[model samples]
Target: MQKLNLSQSLSQKLSPQQIQFIKLLQVPTAELDTRIEEELEINPALEEGKEEETEQSQDDDFEDSYDDDLGRDDHELNLDDYLDDEYSGYKMQGDGNYNSDDDDREIPISSQTSLHEQLITQLNFLKLDDRQKIIGQQLIGSIENDGYIRRDLEAIINDLAFSQNIETDIDELEEILRKIQTFDPAGIAARTLQECLIIQLERKEHPDDPVVKHALLIVQDCFEEFTKKHYSKIQKRLDLDEEGIKDAVNLITRLNPKPGGASDGLVRTQYIIPDFILTNNGGKLEVSLNSKNAPELRISRSYADMFDAYDKSDKKDKKLKDTVTFVKQKLDAAKWFIDAIKQRQNTLLRTMEAILNYQKEFFIDGDETNLRPMILKDIAERIDMDISTVSRVANSKSIQTEFGVYPLKYFFSEGIATDSGEDVSNREVKSVLQGMVDAEDKKRPLSDDKLVKMLNKLGYNIARRTVAKYREQLQIPVARLRKEL
Candidate 1:
């Protein structure tokens, strides 16, 4: 059956310009330059640098003359077709303008050879045949960032036989694996945590030292007890006294748990470029965007001149019409990009201003306790924007404060009610919880139940389970795990 139906409904959709604005708004200061560069490469009409003031009046007159000349023909391109309230020329936000001082400053970036490359370089030092080198390379590939190869040798054998066309037995693979485990890191490619620790201990310059010998024995024998903090069990199983066990445990803790992390200096350090900079001048806190966010962008003057030249020429030629259409599209894209960048700057300032005003106390003193319990809705309402818009700014953006650089998300936390009938930030409670753990007797660490009671005594209405959750969030272990010899 064929049928046609119509019903009244309402729906909303984002225009191309709106979509572009949303994407640009979410980009952080660190990535904004790259995004602008991509746009400049793709759209020939969009260019970098400030728009010249003298050219503005000439461009306006050219547009006016072209509009009047082209408006008469139905087939001719109309300049007004691309002109709208949403379309805007190059406009600058004064706060984000590039400062000559900032341009002159040099930001140091740390670089290093990656972990895999270093491992391969070390692999090259081993004397082996071409086939053996290939097998060794395959083994090196299996090492993870943490410097552990959890894959079974049998599985690797199967992989090599199928993919590399090398039929090697587990013995040959184990021979290569043992050599890799002895790499520079001292624990490079161990199969397990125990193996990693023992490998490091065995490689110690003073392996004959009593502490190193006992540490190796404990790691090789009573690893489970050592991990569970069952010091009594480890003492009984290893026949070690308290001081012997303490020294061995201390040595074990000194070993790099993640061997790959020991080579962090050999990895490129990630720098956090803040989107906002907040400074407390005397008693007032001022917030401003990183100068990078406010990029100087404008429509290409050559493109604009080309459009004017084409529009002023004869309109009867089909080739000219096609060229005009293409030029108009590019101009439209350039205008849209400039307009979107302007909107993004406005939105970022608005959202960040709301957040700065809301947490003014925290910024003044750099105290987490001073931070108000804030959510995306609070800032969104204050800025008269949507919650999602606020979230987009907070999630990926960071602010450089007097204390340190912190992600915008760090200031946002859930509220907790106190006995005084006032709301406080959950971060405050976590701070208190961390303080208690730091000052607790390690031999008999405070349990969650004790933590809850202590918090309640201090006028915080918290439960044991809530205390446990906060503890986990702070990366603090249970009372048992926190125990010491």
Candidate 2:
């Protein structure tokens, strides 16, 4: 049987304004202009530009009049809360305002043709029938950005039959593929890395050269051993001398691993617009938000005038009341949006300032080892904000320093204990590990165990697994794969 019971529970919920602030806070400087433009389009009451200076006494009088005119009647809506100036003390001196440096922030676009277009242009030069041209186009379409057509011939044959409804066989497709492979990039449309390298080598001017022949032979015959760097096995199997093999290896190493990377048309270049600009002035670090982040915004003056007109009108009909309600909503939305943008600017500055102070040593010297072990909680507590808020700021934001631009996430790292009982950033460990790898003998690369021992010798109390983890994170391959001739 069900019984009625009274239960009390407490819960916290974000108001509409607070939710709006959170969303605005996370938007990076790059996309902020677009977001603001969208708001301007939807809300007629909101506008873009500096808020003109008006008489404070007049604004106070307007607010007081609004409260008195719209009494506390159940039928009448109270708009006194929204009548006050939402932009008071909003403008920060020398911040979020127009300046001379605004011209430098514009990004120039490239008009170069893409990779696929160039390939298709070359395809036009081929003398083929309608069917052959279609197959050639199909093969070209299968080529990835790396310039390799990794799709299996059988699968492509099925795809053409099912999707294109064109009956084609493996032999006919392969013929067209070979013709396309003869394109300008030399290695374009190759099925495998070995084939890609061989295709490039075959196009060399001096095909009869001894080194070229050896390189082709090594790639075509002992590709697996060559990839594993088993130079001795390759020598024994090929019955070649050390100098001959080394020269051939050196020649193969110079070949382009990714032929498509050379083409300007296929790859879209991405430019990073940093959210903050940081500079080293004498010994002090200075950080400022990118000018684009600080847009000039204000409430439309005409919209404010509507409230004055509504206040003076003696007749309060149903239609007029509905119009006033609509005006109030638009005004409320405009005020909240402006307030959110202002709060976002303040929050971003606070979070970034705390980070700069916390990692002050690293920014000063541009040294990874100098970075301390910092987490979201550290910055959150310093700014009296939540950890999630700090994370939202760091996740999408970047700062341009005198040395270089870096994502805010780069400054945070876990701590590692040293023999001296001092806590150090794991970035320091990775830095040392990278140095060791770079200086290691090519013929005998250091294993994870060896790296762990070396690190421990330097007074770092780290385990073998942690060293392996760091090695992988650095994109360093295993000892076996790193072996070289």
Candidate 3:
């Protein structure tokens, strides 16, 4: 038998305290308030309330007594000693006053119905038998928010048989699904774009109208070519003129691609809480984190009181000893959390300051042209921190400027060297490309090669493939697809 070494080298990892700090740093301002509430709930020693006048007087007296013996050096105070010090230095001064009166305000919970829920609610009014109702409910549930049934029919049939204990054939199911598709929102349960349009056209009161009927035929038979904007082939097949093709294309364009998205009385607006706020004060750009999102968070005073009580109690008593140990553990945890939050704020401010300094011109003028090439390494080098740390700061953070709020990642772009031997942001090049495309004649669209030449003439020195990649990134199609009649 071979002799084996049993020992293994295990590297020390970050303590729970350090990990908590890193997590806090990653949380943006919008979610900071919720984290504070969570901390308050976990630590009973932590309480949220203003200190009474008598307590404040006692604190002042204690601080005065300590200051007389310790002299004027405040830096010697540790984390615990600092909290015991009169809450003077930490108090928000002048314009930094936080409104404590609205602490009791209740956040309302709205039971807003989703699109599918609304559709299901209407399904109840229809007169259908028990089995048909069950099938309709299943079909309604299958309809996605975009009004498409992307699920495979065979799988659905299997689900109904095994899960719901109901035997259903594809022919019968398809019939009911067609009826569900004809519900209030025209194309509710279509599996494809072609099916969606056909469902709507079939339900039309004037089904024989030349334009409507021709558009339905075009969608059913030549959908692949039609979507590619191959109007000449369609015109040749139908033997129609340019005006007739235009009428059919216009009719198809008017149909709602996402039928479920147009539900009335149900409006959903996304809330955008910015992490950083940038304003111009006397021609100087002033940057500050949105303090409203990050409420004033500190260790609960109740926890401090419990700690004090434990310290004063007799050490010989077993009950007191156990209580002291419990209180110490909780107090240590609370202290670690408070320190982590402070460190997070410091890191965030430092990282954002470096970013603002690097892109001062872009921030001053809300123009994409003013943006320069910047990467995580650039900011990390500027701030003398690790690239990974800088990346964490940028990942989820958002900045609000006079123009609009944008994620921190929006400012960074890879650089491309121009003919003048100067490096420019790829974002700037993309903007230039988009502008050129917007100005180009749709009847005779500019090809990728022509765009590359134009960009080179303008000193960008980009290859044809690079131009094509940029164009595709912007979702602009090829010249053939972009062509018009």
Winner by TM-score between candidate 3 and candidate 1: 1
Clashing pairs in 1: none
lDDT of each: 0.81, 0.84, 0.76
- Which lDDT tens digits does candidate 1 get at residues 1-485? 99999899999999999999999988888889989978876776677778654332234544653332221212333444432323233222332222457556798665667777888888889898888888988888888788888899898998899988999998889998898888978788888999999999999999999999999999999999889989898888889999999999999999998888734425454799998888778897788888998888876655565576664577787766776677678778887888889898898888888888898888888898888899899998898899999999899999998799999999999998999999999989999999999999998899899999999999899888899899999999999999987
Tens-place lDDT digits, model 3, residues 1-485: 88978897979899998899888878877788888778866764444443222232223422342222111221221234333333332222331323344456788898887777777777777787888788888888887778889999888888788878889999989988877776877887899988988888887888989988888878888798899998989988988888888888888888988887744435577698888898999779888878754455444443344444443445586765665566567666766776687678778888888999998988888899888999999999999998988888899898999989989988888888888899888989999999999999999999998998899898997888899899999999999888877
> Which stretches of model 2 miss by more than 4 angstroms?
1-16, 41-44, 54-110, 262-265, 280-282, 307-332
Number of clashing pairs, model 1? 0
The C-alpha local distance difference test score for the whole of candidate 1 amounts to 0.81
Q: Once superposed on the true structure, which residue ranges of model 1 sit more than 4 Å away at CA?
A: 1-10, 54-111, 262-266, 316-319
Predicted structure 2: lDDT: 0.84
Q: Which segments of model 3 are wrong by more than 4 Å? A: 1-3, 6-12, 47-104, 203-210, 260-267, 315-323
Once model 3 is optimally superposed onto the true structure by TM-score, how far is the C-alpha of residue 65 displaced, in angstroms? 21
For candidate 2, lDDT tens digit of each residue in 261-366? 8444355657899989998878978999899988988776655666556664544566666666777787788878988998999999999999999999998989
Each candidate structure's count of clashing pairs: 0, 3, 3
Top lDDT model: 2
Measured against the true structure, the TM-scores of the candidates, in listed sequence, are 0.86, 0.81, 0.83
Cα deviation of 296 in candidate 1 (Å)?
A: 1.2
